[model samples]
Target: MALPWFVKRYPDLNFPVSFPPELLSHIIRDVCYNHDPRHPAFRRACCRMTLVSRAWQAVANSTPSLWRYLLVEYSTSQLHLAAFLRNSGEAPLFLCFRANAPIAADPDMVRQSLLESAVYISHTIRRWVAIDVELKDASVFHSVLLYLASLPSPPLRVLRLACAVPRHADRRSSFAYGFHGPTLRQLALDGAPPWSSPSPPTVALTRLSLHQCSWPNYSDFFEFVSLTSALRHLSIGTVRFAGTLPATVVHLPSLDHVDLLFGSNVDSIPVVASLFSRLTYPALLEVAISFNGYGSVSEFLRTPLAFRASSARLSGICSIDEDFADVYHRLFGVVTLDLSHGQRAMVSALSAEKSHALPLPSLSTLLLYMPNWRSLLDVISSRNDGQLAPLHLRCNYPEHLAVTHHLPHIADHDLESHHRVLSLVSSFSWIHPM
Candidate 1:
């Protein structure tokens, strides 16, 4: 034989005659050394290199792990999509749908394709971390979810769905059965629903988030949460507590954390008072709430449950934000407190006309987001000179939050969290007749 000719073309470089499968990767890497994969040229190089030789082909086919990401625009056709998956190595796929267009799918074909993929995927794909679907309407969700339901997806860990409007009661039932993932964990749904009613309950999920959802009423909303027996972290954008939160709700021996976002808008504080008053989940370690509407944190703080929690967050609470030194003094043991975003405007509106304030003494972690560093220093300092302590500060971009860096008061923590969380309230004095 002619000794495998690629050597003759690059004679100056003196290519190796043969290589172990791993060395083949080094050769491919060198060929595209200066090329950026993010650029079109980089992808083209990959395509061209795959066709180079039989040995290279084996390496290309075996490295399917490189294709762990998936992205699909709204216009992507479902029928063609299955074919794409079949031909593409077993990489996870991500699809973003159109706001107006529904998901196009052939149910039978989708289920069949999933089964076929599983035959090969069980040994090949280690993790299916995320699924992001953005739709124009809820109706589109039905088609995609149905097709997915018929298929097997036990490897999923993160599930996210975003839409302009929320799914109606009828559409929500699609998740009631057929699909199950004991290993499944994070779940987030956005936008408001079209019709409001009690939807299917969810269980086995560790973290749950609902943003701008439409519920039929208070009772219906509670009924929906009755499903999450396994939920550990609960974050809501709107918490409408018009009804009961299940007599069995507090017994969630596994539930220890709670996040209430803008709950005061829908009578949530009163309900929270009622719930904690009636049921006591002693294991509860963290509680995060943005008391933005009405009601004071006094009621919640005075509860019997206070002794059980190690950390808590209350956003927009008048008692906390008004520069009240006493409030900060009461929460001395708090390890991390985030007063960054929600009520900065409220502070500015009232601060311009106030007297000098005292600095906080017990704080170790303080986050500031306002343009006024002077005010921030006053709040964290005991002196007025505006010098800060060694406390960690997370603000604008140069250093965003890494996992270990987040000082998420109480709302974001899971029951499994042991990190010490603490917060300090800003102290306020009268305008002194300015």
Candidate 2:
């Protein structure tokens, strides 16, 4: 058979030519990364891409950059997760293992698998910057910690463990174990009392998030914070303590931002105000107080806390605890007030008198939710502050992450959120990352 017209015209080119290395790289990226269900390559062709040659497949299967943000939201069993972890030589930045199934495996196996996988993840932890892992069961926390302790590189920067974790499975195995998370900066632990101990997590963490937890009494809270001399940022949601926040908590020199999510029993107006007055957040920039997961907003008159706040954000200050509202107005320097969660929200007082209306000397951004077009427009158009360069208006939902272009006026951007999550789960063929 004769060559095609195009092939005949180009005499310099080989008859049945493959792409050059540079072109091949681009082509492979498109096929491996851009290909979808409808318009796709054959199944065999996908596998054949790897077998094209050893060196090519090596490039095809592994891209060091892609390992930075790995999300393991696998729908498979723990055993499968363990197997994959055992083989995954590349380190991932982020990994999420979400399995809500009831406890089905032996305690030791479950714990061991989690430990091994965590160890594997830790190997990459040094390479990548941040990690957000979710495990459903609390039984395997020891394993996770054990593995986390083994990482020799990259300090664990920010860690959010929303999934429950067992506190101590081997009590007799010596309760004197403690890991100094020199690299750990931000930590969010949402678990029960039965699952953890009162030994005090002594990580050099700055940002700490407490949600749906087991710190029932002041002693527990004290013990937890005792190890947090470097603690700065704290976010609390739904807790019923019999006593007040310890004096030591307020004494922490580094403590700054506190996101308080008040439970029905814990939401006291006077106490809320005292938390603001008593503590020291010299560099404290924002305060996002939510109630029952609902975001709220308030206009506060100039106060010590408000004046210092360059970008104070109070989202989900539910039902407007009248007592706290009084203190909220004094926030003078606040530049942003996010009230996206408008439903089930009641502010303490929003003065109709424009003159009396609390002014944010630095205020520039406002986030609000709207039902109709008119509301959206009104919210968008309401920002008169010339300094407010970018005003982001998002829907008002309790749990939903209000997506908008407006981020913190300050830097220290949340790169973790911007990272590509889905790429980690899929095959590594497409990645040409640096």
Candidate 3:
């Protein structure tokens, strides 16, 4: 057979001949993580890469790092499990296992399959850097947690456990494992109580998210919070406290972001307010709060619960709640105010307040989702001294047109009709919808 001159010169050719094995391995890792539509899952991408050729197969098999993150499925065979572990070597692993069966599948079969897989992986808990276990059946969760608890404290960086199914009181004993490892940085517990073990000696945790947890009392939650001195982000979703928060305040020097979502009609305002007053964030930046029942957050916004954060976004604070605008009078340094979820009547009330004219001295960017653009414009005009940053109007096209159309019409009394407010309005450029 005759061949081209270049082909004859090289003789041995590769499909992707230009890239070395290391470079090819790197490219494969990138592609797997990119999670392209063609290869939506990392395992799927890895499987496809292995079929490319002997060269690729060798590369994939030798790349221990590539097999570290595993999403164990019921269909995964023992051979496949062994191969993944063998290839992963000593690299830290991230595992996500859910012992949930499909509608068509038998529950017993699914449980048995998960038990087999869990038994195999439990021995390698030392290598687990992060793990997420979600189970709808409490029996299945208890079985899994029993094996997990038997292991020594894992070198876990992040751990998320969600057991949505109800279980007997005795079932909680299975998850009495302690996570006092120095590297534990993030902890998220759903339908799980705060662990009874001693707190980590190192306060290295930077993020904590508690979702529907059953804490014994406010003291327990506060005690847990006190341990995480290095916490920067905290999210509490529908967590009800049975007892009043302690009079002692917990200062988090590094905290900057907080998200609080209270359950509807739970009367959590006292708990939330006490928690707010307790914590002092000198460097706090952003806070978002959503309360189900509305007496307005005005009471919480008063002095003891004041936010030093430059940005605040409150949801469910109705218009009729007077003194809402009065709260901002203390936040003289707040540069951005997000009232997108604020009521139209509240915006009007804010605009009409005589004290609103000089309340927020540093407020430059005002974000609103109200239909009353004129009222907001009036509020902006009322500001005594501050650089008018662009008004971020998150509204429909009609509202946008109306705002732009009416910006020029300033009342004789508004901003003294000196054209200063109009000039400020002229500087505004419609921001793309966020």
The lDDT values for all models are 0.39, 0.38, 0.44
Q: The CA-based lDDT of model 3 is what?
A: 0.44
- Model 3 alpha-carbon drift over 4 Å, by segment: 1-37, 40-68, 73-126, 135-154, 163-206, 210-214, 226-230, 247-253, 280-282, 303-305, 308-310, 335-337, 351-364, 370-375, 378-434
What order do candidates take by lDDT, descending?
3, 1, 2
Name the regions of candidate 2 deviating beyond 4 angstroms: 1-111, 116-132, 137-159, 164-207, 222-233, 242-258, 263-282, 292-310, 315-326, 335-368, 371-434
Q: Write the per-residue lDDT of candidate 3 for residues 240-307, one digit (tens) a residue.
A: 56766678876654667766655553555565676677777777676666653454466656634445
Better of 2 and 3 by TM-score: 3
lDDT of 2 at 88: 45
Between candidates 1 and 2, the one scoring higher on TM-score is 1
Better of 1 and 3 by lDDT: 3
Candidate with best TM-score: 3
- Give the TM-score comparing model 2 with the true structure, all chains together: 0.45
Report the poorest 10 consecutive residues by lDDT, candidate 1.
184-193
lDDT (10s digit) by residue, model 2, range 90-113: 333333332333332344554344
